[model samples]
Target: MSGKYIIMFKDSATPEQIQKYAQDVSSNGGAVHQVYDASIKGFSASIPDAYFQQLQSSLTDSPIAVIEPDGVVTTQ
Candidate 1:
């Protein structure tokens, strides 16, 4: 069940923090493919099913925003 995820950091998050998180994801067997800094602050990564839950929890716990199945918009 490996998939891509879009992780958006808080406006208050620093570059170092984002970098650290990316490194952590890579260390945990996830592949970080793209990083956004202008007009958006986030990174796109491919996470393996084995580490998906853990990685998701890690981001949430760290207060990093995680958006799954990216590129979809819902309007009410």
Candidate 2:
């Protein structure tokens, strides 16, 4: 079950680090839509469930802040 996800890096994350992460995503049968290294240190991508765990584990002790599903926001 592949799905859209938002991968946010910590403030200490460098641009190079972010780029490497993007490369990892793309190499692992994922599609990176956007990378935010200015105002935000993160990226939005579509990752497959089969590779999600490996991706997360690869970043262990790294600068990654959070990895969560991308979803719509509603205001009512």
Highest lDDT: which candidate?
2
Candidate whose TM-score is highest = 2
What candidate 1 gets wrong by more than 4 Å, as runs, is 58-60, 71-76
Residue-level lDDT of model 2, residues 7-60, one tens digit each, is: 999898888988988998888899999777677789999998877888778677
lDDT of 1 by residue, 1-76 (tens): 5788888888888899999878877988888999999988889888777777776667656747656755667999
Residue 38, model 1: Cα distance from true site in angstroms: 0.4
- Give me the overall lDDT of model 1: 0.80
Q: Please give each candidate's TM-score.
A: 0.76, 0.86
Model 2: clashing residue pairs?
none
